[model samples]
Target: MHFDLPDLRLFIHIAESPSLTQGARKAFLSPAAASARIKALESQLGSRLLYRDSRGVELTPAGQRLLQHARLIMRQVDYLKSEFTEYGTDAAGHIRIFANTTAVTEFLPEVLAGFLAERPGVTVDLQERLSRDIVRGVLDGAADLGIIAGPVQAPGLQVLHFSTDRLVLAVPLGHALAQRQSVSFNDTLAYQHIGLHEGSTLLSFLREQVEKLGGNLALRIQVSSFEAICRMIEGGVGIGIIPESAARRHSRTMQLAILQLDEAWAVRERSMLVRELDALPGSVRALIDRLKQGV
Candidate 1:
């Protein structure tokens, strides 16, 4: 069967979006045109590629295989364009990363600052997402790399150790929980708690865990950053659960107490994820290497 790059690209867009109309819009084609092209592609390949429903479309088994190949082909095509373009100037590339709250807020800023300083020709697009979503984005080619926390079961992705993260309760110097060495997260739910802003991955994870325990987090206030959360706790507004790294950094000036969590999930191993480390472009691989070195 014969198909063109546009056909492959259109299919990739459709699979990523799982919405025919949205995919057509991304490809700069009308819905009717996109549907016709998809029909033609199915006829040529002699396979039913998508299962359509009222909500959206889902890829069939053959479609999943085609998607894997399509992503690889597009990545190679992009690499070729970048390589040829660099003949007239310094090497240039872009990498996309999806990471969780701790990696995005506590870790990546310093690491990326140094990485970008040395490579003026390179750029990065970073987004904060839940660990599960981060894995899916990397696997589906939406992101070039991912940083995830806790345990992950990824079948086809390469995992690299990044760092360890611990979630702890931060309280004012004389708070009742502050006198204790450690406590279950459930024990803190009765007290008012400061929290990160809505939609933060940490806040979302905390909510999920609390729900599992058949309780709710009594959030007293919402703030934008971990530093702000520490400040709020220092002022005796409420206690908050924050990454241990942030707690240590802010504790130097803020009379805050860091108490370890008893739950196993509170201690997490952060890891770097990539679909195929060897297949990545040189510039992308270099950044990963730098991150591994703690630079």
Candidate 2:
């Protein structure tokens, strides 16, 4: 059966939100208009796509099948728009990028600025998420690229090494470890530490390193973002170990002192993730090339 792009989009939105009003808001249409469109789509396809109840909307069996294809179709439509718009335009299109907090606050601003300077027409949309979620975004074709610390071991992803960033200890200016040139893993264990919330890759890496040194890192504050952790550090909540790049960004604003970790505990590597090596768009390729060339 033939289906228009708008119908496909509305279907996907309805399936995602499962609320007629919510889907209508997303589609910028009134609830009545959205419902009419959905009913029209169902008529054309000869199936009931959704069932309404007191709780919310639920998808029918056929709706479930159509939802997957609808997402793929929408993604291809987006890719087509980006691809055609970027051609012969010196990067005049949307590039959706996903990154972790560290990359968002520390690394991406400069890279995006340089890219936009060279190609002023390009628009970049950046979303901050955990590293694993960033990878998932790329893999699912929701984001064109990802900037994260690795090692990420997804099967179908093309990983490119961007730069190495060490993990450093950030202490309040007057803290005892502030004067230390390098802190041992065991030394960090002696203090109450500020850590990223559970499921964070950086937190896991730090925990593993400390455990290896037979150090029980006591986590005092569990924050979800790097900025929050920095503020906590600034408030003298506890010392934090964060990416050197991120620590550098906050050093000017907060009365924080950065100390290097012993080489054994130093975490490094900022990797760029893409869906496939051969599938990169020209705009993405240009950005990656710039990163590799350090231009």
TM-scores for every candidate against the unseen true structure: 0.81, 0.76
Candidate 1 CA-lDDT value = 0.87
Q: Taking the tens digit of each residue's C-alpha lDDT, what string does model 1 give over 96-163?
A: 89998877888789988877887777788999988788988788777889998888888889998867
Off by over 4 Å in 2: 15-18, 36-69, 86-89, 179-181, 184-187, 195-235, 248-257, 262-265
Q: How many clashing pairs in candidate 1?
A: 0
Q: Which regions in candidate 1 have their CA more than 4 angstroms from the true location?
A: 14-25, 28-36, 46-69, 80-91, 197-199, 253-255
What are the per-residue Cα lDDT tens digits for candidate 2 across 1-295? 6888988888788787958889888988898999999999889989998998877799999988788678667766766666677344347666788876667766678888889898876778888777778887777666788888757776788889978878888999889888888987677888999998886667877777767777688999898877788899989999998888778888878889999988654766778898775555567777778777751
What is the overall TM-score of model 2 with all chains considered together? 0.76
Worst 10-residue stretch by lDDT in candidate 2?
Answer: 86-95
| Most accurate candidate by lDDT | 1
All candidates: CA RMSD (Å)? 3.5, 4.1
